[model samples]
Target: MFTTRPEIAGTFGCVSSTHWIASQVGMAVLERGGNAFDAAAAAGFTLQVAEPHLNGPLGDCPIIVHDAATGAQRVICGQGVAPAALTVEHVRGSLGLELIPGTGLLPAMVPGAFDAWATLLRDGGTWTLGEVLEFAIGYAARGIHYVPRICATVQTMRPLFEAEWPTSAALWLRDGGPQPNRLWANPALADTYRRVVREAEAAGSDRVAQIDAARRAWYGGFVAEAIGRFVAENEVMDASGERHRGVLTAQDMANWRAPVEAPVFLDYGNTRILKCGTWSQGPAMLQTLALLRGFDLGALDPMGERFVHLVVEAMKLAFADREAFYGDPDHVAVPLQTLLSDGYTDARRALIGEEASLEFRPGSPDGIAPRTDYAAAVERARAAHEAAGSGEPTVSRLGASGGDTCHVDVVDRWGNMVSATPSGGWLQSSPAIPELGFCLGTRGQMFWLDETLPNGLRPGRRPRTTLSPAMALRDGVPWMAFGTPGGEQQDQWQPIMLLRMLHHGFNTQQAIDAPAFHTEHWVSSFWPRGARPGKVVLEGRYDLGVAKALQARGHLVEMGGDWTEGRLCAIRREADGQILAGANPRGMQGYAVGR
Candidate 1:
């Protein structure tokens, strides 16, 4: 399944996966004069068939698209919404239980990825849902060309497959064990895909109609009905918001919808930065860049001690603001202008020592407006839960476990581009709805049970999302499109990679191939497992003297082996009409194909 480099002399497209067939489908879109967005949609659809462990057709997507024809930039908020059945009381009730993280059971919301696909087609894409989805259906019905990555992941999670969850077990295992490499397609999944196709076709023969029909089938059509029957048979929560188990009901599915909002754009010096709405940390990336702009960053070598130090220090200041002010900005008055103003960045930058690092602390959320009623509501909910008798903790206060996600970046020959991070959840087998073919995302786990917080559960409220797909336009031309699939790491990686390209003058491949460093709890907003409690993980390739220098400055430094960091894919549109694309060599991919 290894991809050989494709020619990029003229038209081009690149897709990365453990499966080769998926790449070809995307390449076909490019060969047929489809724009980057169209090709991305096709590739994304194909992955559902080729890489089941990573995404389901029903997973979530966060997409950033740049149209060269008009210099218009677009973002599709593919993140799911809280189910109608998800009440403040329900979240409060689950707070202390292991299931509070919204894993392995009825989820807080339905998957919104299919809705994104439908949106893309309705807005800019040319292909029909049938055309884009055919390859996925084909791979699902026929057989997938398997590889080592799939085999490894399947083997790792084998015990979950042996459980009584019929759909999860049947899909991942054969003969009561994990499925091995090179096996033919699973008949159950094949049947599911076939039914999906039939349902869509029945819904409407045209692309838009078919897509809408498919989504209906996923939520309220045959699949949801089947799910209802299963839930009824099992005595789980029914369509009504009553308790067979606890949270989630058929009403939630009927009420689900994705929001379309304008991206928050910031002007830092001459550069224009785009961030996800207040529900995500994308704004902090802008704030960090603003802080760094106030410094003398050009004085140091790109990879030298001074450069990394400045970036990390600036991020700490920005992230402190993140913990304090970032949430649903509509609900919480995030003093974003003040936070990004010259005054704040300058003050934060001045606090940094020239040679020594300092412990990170979150900045005050002082001038920002707080939701007093929301806070009181949470307290009331917590009291009610306490009054009723609570169960063990469901929400893992520990950071979210790595579930599954994939990213793609495409810069067309004409400077059109698309960057997207599509992700899935990690709820175990017993929790997933069989007809959906994927687990519900654990995104709601990001919300706090504290009613005082703006991010607490509310009707029609969006959770704080971690994904931010991005595209860069320079001189009115699409210059760069890039994004990654790391949850919290998503915030840290964007600036580091973008700075490498803009300031260090590293080409796409060089930036991606270069070693990366990440700070743990002491530096990063979200720290990963096994990281020494107060240390940052630096690549071993970094000079020991640099680490010593950092440690001397009061920083705790940890070393990282290969590939424990992050994955990135990027494409740059050169002054000429050529597109230069590079995946991360540190990852399982890093090649551009064109012809």
Candidate 2:
């Protein structure tokens, strides 16, 4: 079997990301003596510049970090929370709105990516805030290649900018917008970084103090002030097909900070897989593993219908539980222990049949009946999704259909590792803030309007997000850091690759290179939330017979472009100190660099 690229191996360090430039920047950081945390942060900020159509400064990021010396692993919760004023009564009763608008100011959460990176850098990195930030600042101030996707996404939002978002129009519409492969820059965003660094440096020379001060500058000072003013001042059109102002405020930003918490993990044989807490959909992969443990997966061909169908069925069950049980642990009593308990998984495993199951099933956790408030609407949406051609990839589905995401993975010589997925605040997500040069994220759109459900829209509760980053430890030691950028497909694709790598004896690149698939049977986490009961998007690289076999088993299979499935990046620390890495080749932009 052929692989897209060689699995990068080195003893020094390795960094992989969705964009090549960001990957190189992370490698440079490691070469300059920074740890995995520092390298990830540098790459993340650079991605905001180079891949603005995918992520922005105000986007959310969930990071999994392992410190080799202490042998401790933690997750940085960069997913922001809804505003205090954003309540069911406010939207439904006061505004006469049924659902949270998927775009514009109303759905803006307290932007969380900045503080999340700050916490990572302050806790584990050896670099200063200015040092980690300089890479992004350079690209934003000077220039970087404007990819075609970025140009097209901008064009899609052109009408919105011209009509209402004057600031965005002025910023992006300059020089007839940006042509593909042309050098483009965002001076306003660069100046924002400079002001942040200046204010942070004014606090003194201590590196840790500067990181903290920089956090303050974003959440409490200039960045917050500008964002609050813009959201309060503008009432813009959104996915609801209506105009509305935001509920987010400067106080919301000031009151919020990213928290680092112990990660949730499951022991699958000798492998201990770690994921973010219930606040994210990360544990869905863990749940999938728990369910898959009952099967003899190693006995099946990974590329065969048996494997794909089994995995797809398992994911539908896992994601069903995601919608029913996963939420902010801070806000609800998520019976996580029971959700992953042997008894529960054993029951879930029993539900999988030789044929694909179209029924939406979420098992009872601790005898509590799972509640999906919009369950009735799911079928109607399923039809609509089919009629609307649900198989289209995210970027093509832009403007409220959905926006894309980015991922990064890094491992240092000391064995410290980081896996992060950063997303939201796409140029199409909302209007740009003129002063700050970025828009607020639309993560609040993920919350359901019904207060009875676990993921209902509530004041200050973090939306049950789909931004998941993952890692795995072997024999009680940190080993691999990996993640992808396909929204609900994140966990699905991750487990498939892990299964291939662990069971089929495939290398990292080979596993990533294999044909991938994911189910949209569960309700989407984005705007116009919908589900296609038996829909599975399969990469066309798979044998055509596999598609026929799946369809015979009742799967509503959609054959996607051969190279249009996932953009995963991964890095692993081998037992003998060798660092191995792999990046997705589908997009022709992802890269792995080391040595």
Q: Largest lDDT belongs to which candidate?
A: 2
Per-residue error for 94 in candidate 1, Å, reads: 6.6
- Model 1 agreement with the true structure over 1-595: per-residue lDDT tens digits: 1222322344454543223455467677878887776777887776666666566655678777776677788778887766665666664564333123433444444567777766775577777666777777677667776655666655555543443345555666556433456744655555665776688788656777777777777677666565555544552221112233434445556566556667776665446766677777788788778878876665677667777777777776676566556677656666777777777667777876665444445554445543322233334345534733664222221112246567776666666677777766443323345655554455665565554566666645566677777777675556677777666677677788788777766776666656677654322222111112235677777788888887776667887875556577777766666666666545453345555
Error of 1 at 492 (Å): 1.3
RMSD of each: 6.3, 2.2
Cα TM-score per model: 0.84, 0.97
Query: lDDT per prediction?
Result: 0.61, 0.89
Q: Counting only residues 3 or more apart in sequence or on different chains, how many pairs clash (N, Cα, C under 3 Å) in candidate 1?
A: 22
Residue 14 Cα positional deviation in candidate 2, in Å, after optimal superposition: 0.1
* Model 2: per-residue Cα lDDT over 436-511, one tens digit each: 8888889998898887678988888999899989999999988899999998889988999999988988878988
**Model 1 regions lying over 4 Å from their true place:** 1-22, 94-99, 163-166, 175-186, 203-205, 226-246, 355-360, 369-401, 426-432, 522-533
Clashing pairs in 2: none
